[model samples]
Target: NSKINLAANELLFREGEAGQFAYLIERGRIAILRDSAGEYQLLSELGAGECLGEMALISHDPRMASAMALEDTTLTVITRDHLKERMARSDPLIRHLLQLTLKRYRQSLGQTFPDTSSTQDLDYLEDEQQAMQRMRTEHDLSHALDKQEFILHYQPIVRLADRITTGFEALLRWRRDDGQLVSPDLFIAVAEESQIIEKIGHWIIDEASQARTRLASAYNGKLSEDFYVSINLAARQFPDPELPGVVQEAIRRHGLLAQQLQMEVTESQILENREHAISVLHNLQSMGCRIALDDFGTGYSSLAYLNRLPVDALKIDKMFLDDMLSDQASRTIIAGMARLARDLQLSFIAEGAETEQQVEALSALGVEHVQGFFFGRPFALETKKEPA
Candidate 1:
């Protein structure tokens, strides 16, 4: 049985006081008050079914606001101890609701502006709000990221001249809790913004290397053991002083040869920090690891940096490969890039080659490697290899 009372006006808890009990309004109304300049200001109004003292109940901390009866209000009181005992045996749904309540409270505080402060306080509050939003995004992403939630999909790269499978790129896919497959573009940005890109990038390296090792083991008795796995590297992960050592450890753990794994770096990163990027590339190349400049022509002065960077390959951006037959400029660019790659003794890979015409154009351009939907969309690497 709960203690119920009908309280009148001036029946409120003092500011900075501790809360030992939570209250639920059963009748009339209640007002939540906060101290501003030594005066109480109404923060919110509560009616039937509305609960108060939640934060204090959860943290056992001092109450930041006071609850007072607006009129002759009937309230049911539940002691914090009782609430804790109930929470200890609460159902998952109830626990989730409490968590959501806490999240919403934090969000509200993040968005609220304090009126008693200067303009600087407003700017500070805005920054705090952004930080809080980022934290929430990270929390949600962390819940979504798990080994069981990730799946490896492979897309084949073909030799344009022979129209044969050269190798496959391991792509990450997530079949979300909602049973829908999430596109990389959707979650990749969130992961990057939350600083979780490093974890995801490392996971990709490990998964791709493991797949390559398994394939190698399977084809040990076969005539050809010439498949390669390319994994994209985030620019944020590059500056880590221990990155080279981490890559070496990953290779050893996965039983993969350093030459079999290619690290794909966006061309823009190379152009932005040429010196640092070159040093990193040199370190990787020293370890016998191959490096590919991804989205090659998309960057400014990309051709200029190509000579400076110790990259082994150039991945032609998909934008250039799209509508290759209809776009003569694109065809010319691809041809020039392919010729330059040949002259420089570098491998040229045309990405997103989706049509027969595109494949034919690339072959004619002497582009050796091509990857796109025309060859194969990304799929899980099962034990058996499907036809090229």
Candidate 2:
């Protein structure tokens, strides 16, 4: 019952496409051809019951030839998974030979063998495939980085007292080639797992520093602004010992005051390796780069670390603002946090403030800065320069 149907002269698959299975023609015929100087050269005519594309599953290579239906055709599909199950049940000597063949094949394909231990079970082959997939993803991301597909968006944080913009938070955006935007939540985790995030984090920091100069020049009205740009750092990115030196270099390269480049770290990010993170943060703080303890009151918000670390600001998580009006406890918690920020001499801003009433409430609670949709959505960074 595992049959696939194709209309007359239909393309079963094109050359260079990934193949997962072989096809046994149950009826009609198929033409196997290769592209030669822009025309398809017919290599063979496969009749009913002849197997096609069988070599693809064995080699894990792209289809070497294009396949088209000569007429209406039915195919019995034999999946790679079925073949893998049979291979798994084979003798150890057979499996060992297959491994050696795969190793040689990978070398021909310009790839080294994935890290497989000698004692691994037959499932190591599947793991090897996953390793290849991860490698491909990292390769694509590296190319995306070079192509400048990643961009920076800014959301202004307003000083509630005068309703003036003192600083902006830099948000990362990935615009795919198909014109769809990918959320950072989806891709950042992948980058972090592969350690590609370190490269990305350096890019963000450098961009943030350069942005400070342009913001001051183009929007030159805010001269003597002491404006700052906040950038979020991933937890895995902090362990690098050279991170502080790189940040210092960016500040100097952009002619930016170190205090103008703010690093935002979450409770979890710093908590991962508190001792190591704190040491690096200490070096950065001494260089005059400010740090913000971001998303306060979220998971693992420890006062112990908050007091211990050299943080200059506290960004209250948006969850409290969502129900502050209806819930007294939410209001109380916000008030307490604002008071704590004040007591610690730290700047405070409530995140996700969408309503005017919430802004009014926050203003009354003695919160100085607020950043959310009510003030401004994430604005696109314009590259326009003012006329001389």
Which tens-of-lDDT digit does each residue in 195-221 have in candidate 2?
A: 788989998898888888766665522
What candidate 2 gets wrong by more than 4 Å, as runs, is 1-137, 217-224, 383-388
Rate residue 300 of model 2 by lDDT.
Answer: 68
Tens-place lDDT per residue, model 1, 138-183, is: 6666766563566678777777666666566777776676767777
TM-score of each: 0.63, 0.65
lDDT of each: 0.73, 0.81
* Residue-pair clashes per candidate: 0, 0
Give the TM-score (vs. native) of candidate 1.
Answer: 0.63
Residue 362 deviation, candidate 1, in Å? 1.2
Best by TM-score: 2
Clashing pairs in 1: none
Q: Which ten residues in a row are the worst by lDDT in model 2?
A: 113-122
Candidate 2 differs from the real structure by a C-alpha RMSD in angstroms, to one decimal, of 15.8
Residue range with the least summed lDDT across 10 consecutive positions in model 1: 112-121
